[model samples]
Target: MNGRISLRGLRAKGHHGVYDFERADGQDFVVDVVLELDLSRAAVSDDVADTVHYGELATALVGVLTGEPVNLIETLADRLLTVCLADERVETAEVTVHKPQAPIPHDFADVAVTLRRSRL
Candidate 1:
């Protein structure tokens, strides 16, 4: 049985941009992570030990997202994917990083980067 865990609209402030102003001032970033895994053991055992803790995953992602300055969202997405895949139970991860207040002059909703990774 495949199970999925999703974390959405995680807010954080970080220095990730090409321009000095963008890097210096920082901005709000939203992260969405989806993890795919087999949960048959957890379901049958009825024990938290048999499954991945979502809080731990969120904390790990926060550490990487806020740890240092990243040049691009692509790099950030890659880092997030690595962090998610670190878990032995996770077979696949889909990460999306959203930057709401970008430096673009024109009207736009937001800028985002999405990446999908598998443990093959």
Candidate 2:
């Protein structure tokens, strides 16, 4: 009865860091979201209405990512989790925000933040 909807590696350019250069020039961010919900109706009816619309979710995420300036990926992830959990059908959500080109001087692959939330 449980189903998951996932959107991965969504690319966006936004200002999300501490440094002036980071905030001014902006950078590319990757976002991934997973939503858990009941899928029995969708399974039985074979209709899109019974399931979460991932395209709409993605569009909403893009709006959040580009709409405001955040200082941390953790904040971005929290925002995404909030957006996902706003859906009535969703019981739980997991959001990950990735910063590939971090401004760190040391060699590193990437930095990311992940957060989980459930309907109360």
Q: Specify the highest-lDDT model's number.
A: 1
Q: Name the regions of candidate 1 deviating beyond 4 angstroms.
A: none
Could you tell me how far off, in angstroms, the CA of residue 118 lies in candidate 1 after the best superposition?
Answer: 0.6
lDDT, each prediction: 0.90, 0.89
Model 1 TM: 0.95
Q: Model 1: which residue pairs collide?
A: none
Tell me the deviation in Å of residue 62 in model 2: 0.7
Write candidate 1's Cα lDDT for 1-120 as tens digits.
Answer: 999989998888888888999788988889999999999999999988888888888888888877798889999999999999998899999999998988889999879999999987
- Taking the tens digit of each residue's C-alpha lDDT, what string does model 2 give over 1-120? 998988999988888888889889998999989899999999999998888888888999998888698888888888888889888999999998989999888999878988998886
Q: Per-prediction TM-score, please?
A: 0.95, 0.94
Clashes of 1: 0
